[model samples]
Target: MSLLREAERCIANQGSHATLNALITTLQHLGPWLERVRDADTRRTQGTSKSAVDGRLIAIKDNICTRDLPTTCASNALDKFTSPFNATAVQQLEEAGAIVAGKSNLDEFGMGSHSINSRFGPVRSLRRNRDGESLSAGGSSGGSAVAVATAQCYAALGTDTGGSVRLPAAYTGTVGFKPSYGLISRWGVVAYANSLDTVGIIGKDVSSVREVFGVVNRPDSRDPTSLSSFTRSRIDSHLRSPALAARATSPLKIGVPLEYNISELSPSVLRAWSRSLAYMRRQGHTIHPVSLPTTTLALSAYYVLAPAEASSNLAKYDGVRYGTRSEGPNSATFPSGYLYASTRGVGFGSEVKRRILLGAFSLSADAMDNYFIQAQRVRRLVQHDFDAVFRAHQPIASGQPETNTNPEKDAVDVLICPTAPSSPPRISSLMDHNPRASPLDAYMNDVFTVPASLAGLPAISVPVTVESTIDSRDADLAGIQVIGQYGDDSLVLKVAELLDGRHL
Candidate 1:
């Protein structure tokens, strides 16, 4: 069997699987490597041995660097650019025997909540249902989610700065996993917010996502920010302890954050959440109401912090070292600096530019003390709030005192919430109406997701069934997010599986 054959089989069997509609263009861009994978039978074999992932077809997000493919990050700024080196995660996937299928689309620089910001085009959901109405596939990882959902690939890699991975997974009815920050190397990924950006995996199920994570979760010396071996070991040791292991076997205590139940949540989402909680309760898991007061401030804080970091990180693209350079009409009259500004202005999408400007302004001396510093302070409070509610204590560095003194007082092992406040909006509605509305309306899409991202926690979004009448679409998918303490990624996946009835 070949990669395409296997993918075709998946699509035939799985109604909501990937649609390779424009894959010819991708094949042309990927060249010979694409041909090799398409023709090789050895690449499609599946097993649990060292070669388990060998020959497996995998999709790479446009932002994740691949030496053989163009890494545009869904922006025209790098439309003609191909990376010289693979992202560490991409290299790991290849080494594990996975074949790089092609680059998936995304919101420009991972900025948009809906896939609408892409230079390539919006990625539509694979969940067509009976209605035949087209819906968003959640973004900025929407393309990756769609690829996985539609069987375009066995699995796909996406960068999750906030809810990019989980949101799309929810929309497309696939599994999206954002592992503990720094667990996977960020080395070849185009930076959005260096501190918040994480490489995520989107697959057909928890098992596939876990399998992919197992391959890429090792520490990379190249990523200076990668978690150290000692820290990884410490986390593993704690999670494997008899107490934690036994707790895993027993029913878990899941928390429902009061702050997450905002007014904007659709009635369908509310019903799905209620049913999810009811199901968990019936399964013997204890449900508790937890308070994370600072969560209300998370969205505001994230906008401030992420943009600030984005502005600084994006400063490298000054028409000099990387990205396309625009030589003004007259090179004699227009010098280096002048052309750089115009080039960036023309190249980046509106959303990206908006963020860059917001970020740059936040870091300005006048606003730094009031907005940026306050946001950082609020971010810490958000993290503290999470630590205060989870059962496990985050392992602090040696000689660093445990900040979570009230760990014993916390209510649950993990938190449960809706992945998005509402269902996927039509692409036309988002583009025609949203842009004219306040930028904050667009930012609201990240509300349920940003709190977890700000706390650097692991979260997963699993689709739940819903009822809908739009084109009689059978209410195909609704997302329920399961969030765990930092380093408790395995626990989050387990709980998500349990909730989805895959574990039972």
Candidate 2:
């Protein structure tokens, strides 16, 4: 089909799926995207062939910058803001012939797990509970996952800072890929946690996610943290080595992190997890029960560290510099201090404000040692725990041997686990009036996905269908995460495809 035709079809789907609120802005906001599709169609008619992703429509999360569209972050603070230039990832994809469908809704500054904290309202899941109540699509990247799930777009871009992308994909029954840190440029993405934040891809399948990743996973001069070409070449070389190649073609060593089998896991999710592992075992792969003792501390450490970084990153939005300025008589008097106070008080949502406050306290002189600094130490231990079990040596960090020697016989090539602790939670359960709901309960959603983010490793969440006895739904889906050593993205995607039964 022509690019323009595909874009039109997606736009039509977006209108029909309006109840999901997957996109914050739609037809009216897609002028630039339509122009791009038209140009791509013109080029195609002229007999020009380009990238595999060319002519495909992809959704951009609100936090990612797009020059032509308002980059709201789903917060009133920047609700009307538009970037002067496109984000590096967005530009790279467009250069490769992809079209930006529109900006999707998100948690205010990507702060919440349920995506209910957005100024634009919550993103509803395509899936529902046994009671027939709507379910959360999962946060921060909830809208992107929904867009892909409902065929509103071919794929979508989401920023995963501690499993934002993966969790949403799990809820929405889509595939989400969070590539290794520094592989994708973060130049234009709004920061949540500098250390843990990563640009991720959500699509209907692993192949689609992999294709999108290939286009934007290049070193960018604008992003200081982006991995250098030399480092990338070294990683590529390591993967092509005889030992790695032999392991790739042969039966694999997959790890099952015992730490992830928490009591909070629902019965349905646990059953799905076992089914996924059993499928891999049937394919002749070995499953080794690995211990990542530090895994238990990862979630707590992430909250502290992410909020601290967020407080720093969000400080620039004090109305004077970036955020929306308040209206009324007191708004203009900067020396009076009312301007910054009123603007922010009215601009930020409850969840964003709560995080900002938590962050502020952690960074305070009296609390830094007990909180922020301790979190940093825990983060390091988390990284160490991952390095201990993976056979592939870290390419960026020298001094470590090329391959692990300790527990070498049991070292795993990849680890498989649940992406979220449970299936999609009921949307009503996240509301303020719910007596059972609390911030702590919301934080538990990230328990399974945070360890991989803290380690800066590559991970992908693939949807698995399991038999369901709930009403007439017939089947329920769970997200199974496949994690690999830093820079082992290709291997991780391969395993995800295998579990998806593509290779079988």
Candidate 3:
């Protein structure tokens, strides 16, 4: 079917799903591409295409730039901004004949755990089992998750700085895959944290996500931090090793991080995790308890490091360059600095400003050594801890011998854990009553998901069954996260497929 026809079908059947009301923007932005469906048809018929993703409809998170559409990052500051060029991933998709459907809404600059921070409004969950109580589709990537869950697009791209993509997928009953950092280029993605930000994929299942990944995983010259060809080859070699290849085909050992069983885990989530492990064991995979000792400190280090990088990345948004400009009442009295201050003060949301200020304070000379530097050290420790647990070595370009090895010990193929500590909270509860919840409490939502992100490893969230008394009308979905070594994306998807009882 043509992309246009798929879009029409989506429009026709959209009401069947309970999606976020503020999901789509103007459809006019997609008109030119919609008119060229025949071009995609021609490419498909020609059959000798170099691009694996030809003729697909892809949804983009609001933060991913597309020359033809607005890249708002769900922030008021960039509300009127549109990029002059496509993001590296977008360009690759288009080259492969994928039609850009429309930009999906998201938490402001990928900040919130719920899609509530969007300027367009919160993205509602689509998991309506039957009494339509609104549930949060996990945040930052909530709109992307909802878009995929509702079949608004075949696959949607999201950015996972923390658990943005994985959490939403867990909440909405979809597949969310965060590739190893630097595997996919991030040249045109609006920066939240340059180091931690990674483009992720959300789809109805793991196969769809793998198909999209195959198209966009090439290194891009535009992304300075993209992994080099040398590193890619190294990762491939590790995966191709005869013993590793054999393990990949058979039921391999999977580790359940001991620290993930925290007090915050809901009974439903705990039950689901246990059930998933039991199912894996029944399938012959060994489930073992693993220790990631540094995990307790990951949230704190991430909050500091991510914001610190964000503070530096966002400095370009002064009134003189990009983003909104606000004229202070006393602009004439202080022409130079007041405009910038007023612009940022008025344009940025409260949470964003709060983060920016916190980041700036941490980077200040007084706190640099004590906070920022210490946070960096903790970040390294977090990565080190992951490296110690994973079987495969990170393919660094320097050609250094892989160290920290325990020859007698064998590492598990993948790590299994809960995607989020609990089920989705009511949007109203989060907005109105959760004011007493500290920022730290909010950050904890990504605790189980971040260590993989920090380590630049691929991870996926797959929805598992949960027994609930909450009305059947409200779809109560939860997920278990499966993490793989770098470049082991295929294995992760296979495991998710096995657990979800979907054909791989």
Candidate 4:
């Protein structure tokens, strides 16, 4: 079929609303890529068969480079920055026949938890509830989540450093999948933190998420961090599954973390969690009580380690080298390096500045052993805790399996828990939160999702229902997370599918 005919077919399936605003997305950077699609179709007709995302619209986060659009990290520091190259992920999407709809907004340098840190504006979480007020779309990938939820595109790509991708999925009630670190290539993506970064996929359903994941999960010769094929095979050999049965129908042993049952967790979230566990047990899955004692230290270690890496990565943005400059009282002293100081003072946002300072402090000579070294030790313990509980052995390790600390019969296959501590909070409340509790309260949002990140494991968040007694305005509710050991992404996604449903 002709390219125009294919475009028309996609529009027909989406109905009037989707057709009218097909190219307009959360952040307005570039659009209506009709020419790009025509070019792709011409190549397709002359060359080979179509791909999974042929003629589909997809949104790329602003942090990921695109030759056609500006690659601002949603901060004025790079307001005029446009890459001369396309990120490896974007190149893969185009090769698979997907068209770039536009670039989405995000927290400045992927910093904030809620999506309000952008210079462009905050991403508002909207739905069909017939209300004018919009709650937060979770951050640093908030705009990507909103784009998928509104059907602005077939799917979108987000980079998860901490809980950027999964937390937004929980708030917006969409499917967010963060593949195991190194599974997806990171070439040409602007660095936030080198070790923790993973390219994630967000879609309206698990099927779409899985389809897109298949296309990008390949070894990239250009990316130094991309996992080699040999390592991937070894990990697959250690995966847990019944003798010859496919994992989809096999009964699972799901772990519920005892530490997540804290005083701060809301009553509504607790009820929803209880209901999800009850439903899973009815389906004949075994439920086990588990403990990761290092889980409590996860948040503190992440803040230190992420900031330290970020400080080093962002050092190149001195006005003379990378970022834009600003006029100041000391502008006349350009050669003295004072102008670089003036430009950065005006360019960076409050949150970015805060993290950069904290990161720098952690890496300083006087504080290295006390802060940086201790944080590194804690990160290792977090990974060890995860390896000890799963049935499959850690492929990265060459020796025998580590001793299991749990007294249960065997290691659980997957860990299931609430994605967030509570439902989406009203925008008004967050803006007016007490001064003392503001930033710390925001940091707590990632508390449940960060453990998997520190371990470099694959994790996903799928929406589940909340209690009826909660107000109708609270309809957005919370999500349930399923985390798997390294290379166990397929099973993690399957468990999420089995658990997805409305209130039981």
Candidate 5:
């Protein structure tokens, strides 16, 4: 949190609009927002309690509901729309005295990977090269990540259905923590994928994210998907073993998934991965090789399942029942269904349209078993792979614990790997469809991140630099991801601290 104050001071002293412009969403009026916070603080009643985040200026991803600011997901579909209530997460922060900095930008409907599929225009990066060339800020939570990176806010809220939070954190070299699904309530947030969508926190470092996570990680009755007290007790009882407690101060077992060492991994990333592993080994943590065979199929299954869910979730926005109605007639003819068609046609962006079509097709009777069912099967397999590799069992499942017969060869405490295959590509390359970058190219960035999302595991991304210098050495600093079993968020953040902070 202090780092954010330092960033504010730096901005004030330097007067760097370039840094601010690359991050601020043009559709909203945003700034340090100190005056608002001070006014609210003065109105506080005596004996009113405040948590660690009191008086903190925080940014919310535009997708999250906020009563004060408009909740536009950088898409025309919900443009200039204001919610009457705040997201549970937002409400919790405000209760703790955190002020809204602004609603940062994101991909339209949380669809695109590069934040360019927005009516508000793509989110620009604060990262620049020797020639002052711009780079990507990642997406669909790119703007939230950039806000934290530029020191525009103490921490920002983002959603990660499939690496939306992690990828941006990696690209911008900030800390992004995607807690196990259901840890934070998602009731007020716009739905992307009901099952997979998770509200995440982005900060300059692990401490900020940890603090934010502490404030918001609680169950809410509004969100049926939110973890219940019974589930929390289950998670606690399952993980409160003496062995787990003993490992707190002991060396850890870190797994290096062989499948993640794909051919597409850049040399810079490879080097950073190797060095981080070496560092852990030197710290006495055993580095073991593990395999999640379904890793490669995760992205494919995610696209199928997520779109299928999106199609169902977005059905309400027909302009008649939900979306913005057009002033003009529905169509030239066929007045009955024209309103629905025309409103959706104009309201949704190309990417949103594409996913909806794909989702509808997958859910069709002819393709349901072949596509949607198959994708669900793949998702289950992905989850099974993680379960098989983790030392702990699922919090809610009733089963005999899987015994690690060999103490020296037990399941890993965590999996350490690169967050993305390569450093962020230049923004120009991502925007243009030249041979260097195509429409499909952005999807590849999520290759390393989708598996964790599919499995609902706790994952954290922290910046780690490579020892050997290479091309684009500055940007070569990559995010090393630490993933743990479900409900192992504390351990995941503990490892994130080890990698990013002086304290272990």
Candidate 6:
């Protein structure tokens, strides 16, 4: 733990969580984390450094990029932008030695679930409320899961388009993940819904978010929606088949999404989703109960295809070539239509101008065939209802054919549910000057994380807890999730480390 005492214990947990603003550019000094711990101790005394996130630290998520901080996606339209480089997942986590413990805040371009539409405010939650206020840290990766749940950073880097990094790692308990949508590499992130952005992580477990998703998951080629090295070697030869290496040493059916048991959960998240499916059926694993039935129209087809691809990736943040240009009185007789309508009306945020006017009236032309072609045909029937209940086989459905398995009543391999149907609310009851706030009551907290981000699949979230006699710091932790199937994502991080018992 001596990378200078883990960067002085992550700068003393970022100065005791500094009022959980989580981070929006930090490491003002520690001289670049002590010059990368003295260049990893002079490359480990010349044997040449071996790095597996070597000096760790992490954070990131103010909307990815990061050539030395300030990627302010907690936007006043990229407020003083900064990134001239870095963000192939932050240059592969700074070439695997990690560091960058700053730039965390969000929900401006990433658009709120409750990081309270930041411009640099709201991202509080190390869980307070006994009238100590500070709650909703669940947002656009709520300051990267409250800086890895108050440790400040050992893991972060959020993005996940809908369910902004697993509803802030299930409202700040930690863990997150979200990989599998072009498996990590949205060439320096920033574009909100370019086919539902990904690149997620936020850790504290699931083996440090599967060791930073095995180092940026690979294959970028300047990310034209990355995922090709012959489709990641045909998803590593279909997970080393022989029926997926004998169903990975057996015992895992695990589905349970009977439409995510909604009744808006909350009886301690339906008792931590019935005690995490009764502890994964007492670990012999076999839960079934599947049926994705296009999961209640996958949150109205992900708020209409993620605001019609965030109204065409935020129309290149117009204000003459990307945001922050607002001068008024028709800047010299309509200078380029008043600096593109006063720099997106004084630089976004009011939930990014209500999702860019609901992604510009669902990509208008009289509501493009009833809301962007019926939300892209309900996002291909929510990816054909998760490739018809999982059982592996959907490495991007190439050459079709494999979904015919029965393995005991309609297949299954991952899927668990209940990431946010309650727990972590009270940031003044999702403020907007309260009065019973409503942006569809914060888009109903992304209804169980927008059906695995509208089926880009691979998910996570973890957290858990529940058995409460109260006061275990007021127990009820929640956030279950899991998902998978579209490149199974190492069976969704090995079934989220076997439902957080950390693979017991």
What local distance difference test score does each model get?
A: 0.80, 0.89, 0.79, 0.79, 0.81, 0.79
| Residue 368 in model 2: lDDT | 100
Query: What would you estimate as the lDDT of candidate 3?
Result: 0.79
Q: How many residue pairs clash in each candidate?
A: 6, 0, 4, 0, 0, 1
For the record, the alpha-carbon RMSD of candidate 5 to the native fold, in angstroms, is 3.5
Ranking by TM-score: 2, 3, 5, 1, 4, 6
Worst ten in a row by lDDT for model 1: 16-25
lDDT of 2 by residue, 334-356 (tens): 57657678788888989988999
Q: Using Cα atoms with residue i matched to residue i, what is each candidate's TM-score against the true structure?
A: 0.90, 0.95, 0.92, 0.89, 0.91, 0.36
Candidate 5 regions with alpha-carbon error over 4 angstroms: 1-49, 331-337, 398-408, 432-437, 470-475, 501-504
Angstrom error at residue 260, model 4: 1.0
Candidate number of the best TM-score: 2
The collision pairs in model 1 are 17-149, 17-150, 17-151, 18-150, 18-151, 43-55
Pairs of residues clashing in candidate 2: none
lDDT of 1 by residue, 1-504 (tens): 555567555435333333422121243334455455554444444333344556577888888889987788878778688888999999998877678777788889999887878777777774543467677778898888887876777888998998899988888888889988899999999999999999999988888888899999999999987998998998888777675677756888889999899988898788788888988999899899999999999999999999999999888876667776666643224553364776787678899999999999999999999999999999999988988887777764354334445655464789999999988876656774655655677688899999999988999998788555454545546788999988998889889887662211
- lDDT of candidate 3 at residue 39, scale 0 to 100: 64
TM-score, prediction 3 = 0.92
lDDT of 5 by residue, 215-242 (tens): 9999999999999988898788767778
The 10-residue segment of model 6 with minimum total lDDT is: 330-339
Candidate 2 segments whose C-alpha is farther than 4 A from its true place: 1-5, 29-47, 328-330, 334-339, 468-473, 501-504
lDDT of 4 by residue, 369-438 (tens): 9999999999999998888787655667556544335443658878888888987765555553445438
Candidate 6 lDDT, 380-431, residue by residue in tens: 8878877777776676565766543445467887878788888887887777
By summed lDDT, which 10 consecutive residues of candidate 5 come out lowest?
A: 21-30
lDDT for position 381 in model 3: 82
